[model samples]
Each structure stands twice: as structure tokens, then as C-alpha cells.
Target: MKARIYVTLKEGVLDPAGKAVVGGVHALGYSEVSEVRIGKFFEMELKDSSDGERIREMCGQLLANPVIEDFRIELGNS
Candidate 1:
């Protein structure tokens, strides 16, 4: 089984890296690009018995910052 985690900044949080990327894109003549936000992606191989609750615990405890970040989990047999 596989677990996928996506961690992203909450709305209204400052993202300097994302902002820098936006500026870089516009400097490359892609002025149409307006915004860019950065996030984290994690892929883990878990035992078949691993449950969503356990995966969520990992996110809440270490994988994501509960104060400024939100996470989503996806589980699959692949």
C-alpha cells in the first residue's frame, strides 16, 4: 500500500519562496503568470494494514505544521 501526503501553507500566510518564483517567472517574460505557492509532497509505502488514522497522526505530529500548514492524505493499493 501507498500513502501520499500533501502539505501546503494556509491562506493568508506569507510565502517568500513562492513569491520569489513568481518574480522569476515574470522576469523570464512570462508576465501572464501571476501567483505561485509552494507545498510539500510525500510518498510512503505502508503495510496493507496501515489505516488512515495512523497516517494522519504522522502528518499532524511531524510531516506538517498544524499552525500554518494543512495536509491531505491519499491511500492506494498501488
Candidate 2:
């Protein structure tokens, strides 16, 4: 099984990288792109597909910063 995790900043958190990207887009004349946010994506191969708790634990423990970030997990066949 493949477990994919998406890590993103929580609401109300400061995102300098996101701001820089948005500014750069505007500078490049893409004014239509008014907002930009950055995040992380992780993929892991698991021996047991049913062991979802392990994946969740990994995300909570290391994959994402709990204080300022949130993560979503998706499971599927590799």
C-alpha cells in the first residue's frame, strides 16, 4: 500500500514563502494569481495496508508540525 500525506500550514499561521510566491507572481505580471500557498507531500510504501494508525502516527509525530501545520492522509495501492 501507498500512503500519501499532505502537510500544510494551519489557518492564521504566517507563511512567508507563500507571500513571496504571490508577490513574485504579481511581479511577473500574473496579477490574476492573487494568492499562493506552499505545502509538503510525502509518499510511503507500507507492508500492511490496514495499518492506518501507524501512518497517522507518523504524520503526527514527524511528517507535520502540529502547532502550525495540518496533514491529510490518503491510502491506495502502489
Candidate 3:
């Protein structure tokens, strides 16, 4: 089984890397681009796809910052 995780900053949190990318995009003549938010994507292989609780624990403990960032998990057959 395969598990995919997406981690992103909360709505009010500031993202410096995203801001830098937006600046670069504008400089390249894409003035219509307004904002960009950066995030993390993780893929893992799991022995038991039904183990959602353990995956959530892993995310809360290490994968994402619970205070400033939110994460979503997607599980699918490999």
C-alpha cells in the first residue's frame, strides 16, 4: 500500500519561500501571479493500509507542525 501526505502552512502563517517564488515569477513577466504557498509532499509504503490512526500519530509527532501547519493523508493501493 502507498500513503501520500501533504503538509502546508496555516492560513495566517507567513511563507518566506513562497513569497520569494512569487517575486521571481513576477520578474519573469508573470505579473498576474499574486501569491504562492509552499508545502511538503511525502510518500510512504505501509504494510497495513488500514492503520490510519498510526499514520495520524506519525504526522502529529513528526511529519507536520500541529500549531502552524496542517496535513492531509491519502492512502491507496500500490
Candidate 4:
């Protein structure tokens, strides 16, 4: 089985990287942009059955910062 994880900053958290990307996009003459929120993406192969609890534990433990980040998991067939 395959699994994917997405980590992103919480709603109230500040994202400097996202802001920088927005500026860069507008500088290149694409001024129609509105906003961007930067986040993390991960692809992994899992040997066990797709378990939500275990996956959530992994996210909380190391995949994301619980203090300021949120995560979502996507599971797929191998």
C-alpha cells in the first residue's frame, strides 16, 4: 500500500515562505495572483493495513508540528 502526508501551517500561523512566493510570482509580471499557502508533501510505502490512528500518531510525532501545523493523509493502492 502507499500513503501520502500533507503538512501545512495552522490558520492563525504566519507563513513567510508563502508570502515570499507570492511576491516572486507578481514580480515576474503575473500580478493576477491572490495568495499562496506553503505546505509539505510526503509519499511513503506502508507495509501495514491503512490505519487512521497509526497514521495520525506518525503525523503528531514527527511529520508535523502540532503547535502550529495541520496534516492530512491520503491512502492508495500499490
Candidate 5:
């Protein structure tokens, strides 16, 4: 099986990198972009152990920092 993990900053957390991107976009004349939020995407292959519950646990334990970020897992066919 395959798993895709997305990790992002929490709502109240400050994202300097995202802010920088937004500024850069604006500077490049893309004014339509009102905001930007940067995050991480990880793709991995797993064996039979790749269950939803286990993937969620992995996100909470290692893929993300629960205190300042949130994560979502997408499962894919083997």
C-alpha cells in the first residue's frame, strides 16, 4: 500500500515561510493570491501494516508536531 501525509501549521501558529512566499508572489504581480500556507507532503510505500489508524498514529507520533501543526493521511491502493 501507499500513504501520503500532509503536515501543516495550526491556525494560530505563525508561518514565516508561508508569509515569504505570499510576499514573493505579490511582488511577481500575482495580486489575486491573497494568502499562502506552506506545508509538507510525504509519500511512502508500506506493507500490510499500513492501516488508517496506524497511519494516523504515525502522523501524531512522528510526522507532525501536534502542538503546532496538523496532519492528514491519504491511503492508496497497493
Candidate 6:
């Protein structure tokens, strides 16, 4: 199975990198870019494990930090 994990900062968190990207976009004349948020994408391949709960636990424990960010995992047959 293949899992795609998206990690992103929660609301109210100040993202300097996102701000920098926004500033650069504006400098390049993309004034229409009002907001930008940066996030991470992780693609993982795992063995065939029927335990869905364990997979979720893996996401919470190793794949994502629960304090400042949130993660969504999409699992599919590879």
C-alpha cells in the first residue's frame, strides 16, 4: 500500500517561509496572490497490514508532530 501524508501548520501559527514566498510572488508582479501557506508532502510505501488503527498510530507518532501541525494520510493500493 502507498500512503500520502500531508503535513501543514495549524491556524494562528506564523509561517516565515510562507510569508517570504508571498513577498517574492508580489515582487514578481503576482499581486493577486493574497495568501500563501507552506506545507510538506510525504509519500510512503508500507507492507500489507490489515490493521488500520496501527497505521493511524504510526502517522500520529512518527509521521507527524501533533503540537504545531496536522497531518492527513491517504492510503491506497499500489
Q: Backbone collision count in every prediction?
A: 0, 0, 0, 0, 0, 0
| Model 3, residue 18: C-alpha shift (Å) | 0.6
lDDT per residue for candidate 4 within 18-52, as digits (tens), equals: 99999999999989988999999999888776686
Best by lDDT: 1
Residue pairs with backbone atoms closer than 3 Å in model 2 (clashes): none
Model 4: lowest-lDDT 10 consecutive positions: 47-56
**Candidate models: Cα lDDT each:** 0.94, 0.90, 0.93, 0.89, 0.88, 0.87
> Model 1: runs farther than 4 Å from truth?
none
TM-score computed on alpha carbons, candidate 6: 0.89
Lowest-sum lDDT 10-residue window in model 2? 46-55
TM-score of each: 0.96, 0.92, 0.92, 0.90, 0.90, 0.89
Q: Residue 15, candidate 3: how far off, in angstroms?
A: 0.7
lDDT of 5 by residue, 1-78 (tens): 899889999998988988999999999999999888999999988895657897789889998999999988889874
Using lDDT as the yardstick, the better of models 3 and 5 is: 3
Candidate 3: segments with Cα more than 4 A from true spot: none
Question: What are the per-residue Cα lDDT tens digits for candidate 6 across 1-78?
Answer: 888889999899899999999999999999999889999999888887756677778888987789988988788986
Residue 77 in candidate 6, Cα distance off native in Å: 1.6
For model 1, how does the per-residue alpha-carbon lDDT over 4-49 read when each residue is reduced to its tens digit? 9999999999999999999999999999989999999999999999
Residues 1-78 of candidate 2 have per-residue lDDT tens digits of 889999999999988999999999999999999777799999888887368987799789998999999999999996
TM-score of 2: 0.92
For candidate 6, the C-alpha RMSD (Å) to the true structure equals: 1.3
